[model samples]
Target: MKVNPTTLSWQAPTTNVDGSLIDYELEYEVGIAGDSTEGDYAPLATIPGQLRERETYVAPIADLPLDHGEHTIALRSFDKAQPDRMSEWSEPVTFMLATVPERPLELRVT
Candidate 1:
C-alpha cells in the first residue's frame, strides 16, 4: 500500500484584531486532531515568522504523523513582536487518508 501526501494551504491574514493593516512578518503553527476531537489536536509544525513573506502558505503532509483515517486540521498565526499573542484557529478542515495498491510486476498464463 502507498499513501499519498497531503498539501495544506491557507491565506495569510492582512490585518490585526483592530482592523489595522499588519506591519510585521507572521509565523504559523499547524495542528491536527484525530477523529475530529477538539482536545485531541496536537501541534504538527511551527513555521518561523521571518522565513515567509507571501500572502499564502503551503505545507507538505509527507512528514506529518497521520494515520489511514479521518483527521481534522487547523492553524494559528503569530508574530515576533508578540510571541505570546496568537490569532484564533481557523475553521477545521477534515480529510481522509487512503492508500493505493501497487501494480502487478509480472503475470503469466497457465
Candidate 2:
C-alpha cells in the first residue's frame, strides 16, 4: 500500500479459481481501539470492481477524518463471484496525522 498526502493506493489481489478470474469486493473501516475488543468502529467505504487484470486501486484520503494521533485502517477483499467467500484481510494500516509544533526560542549574548 502506498500512502500519499491525500490518498492510499494499492494493487488488488487476483485469485484464479477453476478457469475464471474472480472479481474483488473491497471494504474498509477506520477507528481507534479502546479496550481490546471495543471501539467506535464504523464502515468507512466499500469499493467494488472486477479484477479482470492486474491493476492498482486507490482510496482517497480526503474521505477520512484527519485527526491528531494514531488511527487504524482496515481493509478486506472478497470474491465477487462467490459472495460467501472472502480472502484473509490484509494487515491493518495505521497512520498518524500530527500537526507541526511551533517553538519560541531566543538567544542572548553578553
Candidates' lDDT values, in order? 0.74, 0.55
Worst 10 residues of 2 by lDDT: 26-35
Model 1: worst 10 consecutive residues (lDDT sum): 1-10
Prediction-by-prediction clash tally: 0, 0
Residues 17-88 of candidate 2: C-alpha lDDT, one tens digit per residue? 455565455443333333355333445555555322347666667666566666666666655556566554
Query: lDDT score, residue 88, model 2?
Result: 47
Error of 1 at 62 (Å): 1.3
lDDT of 1 at 55: 58
lDDT tens readout by residue for model 1, 1-110: 22354677777889999999989878888788655556455788786654443855777776577778766778889886776878888887777788778889878888
RMSD of each: 4.2, 6.5
